[model samples]
Target: MGFDGPTFAFHPDRRAQLRAELDAYYARLYGLIRDELSYILDPADVMGDDYPSETFRVLKNNELREFW
Candidate 1:
């Protein structure tokens, strides 16, 4: 299986914004509440200071810009 549709180019910023929007839409469809989505984007919010390295930091930042 592969993409067969026409392709168009988008600036890096625009592509990130679009990806964030799509992720948020799917999160809603999957029944993720705001808090759940937030956690998925940034586990550090709920994790303790000694917790391991950050998770999805880039996605979290991108979503903050595009979703919030």
Candidate 2:
């Protein structure tokens, strides 16, 4: 995942900004989706009191395939 040399031959200057924006966007989107599902009948808080706590940390801001 680490690219050496120029990050982007076309738009290297915007790499930092883009990465930060993507991270935040995904974070908010993840929070919203979790709220929508309400934990698929289990009633869980993905964010938990301490986020990045193994379980939620593993799936941080990303959807994982559950059934099929």
lDDT of 1: 0.75
Colliding pairs, model 2: none
Q: What is each predicted model's overall lDDT from 0 to 1?
A: 0.75, 0.50
Q: What is the lDDT of residue 52 in candidate 1?
A: 78
- The most accurate candidate by TM-score is 1
* lDDT for each residue of candidate 2 in 2-68, tens digit (9 for 90 to 100): 7678564655447557966775677577774645444431234644645433434344444234211
Clashes of 1: 0
Give the 10-residue window scoring lowest on summed lDDT in candidate 1: 42-51
Candidate 1 lDDT tens digits, 40-66: 766677676566766776765766797
Error (Å) of candidate 2 at residue 62 is 22
Tell me how many residue pairs clash in candidate 2: 0
In model 1, the Cα lDDT at residue 4 comes to: 91
Model 1, runs deviating above 4 Å: 1-10, 53-68
The Cα error of candidate 2 at residue 26, in Å, is 0.3
RMSD to truth, every model = 5.7, 11.6
Off by over 4 Å in 2: 1-13, 32-68
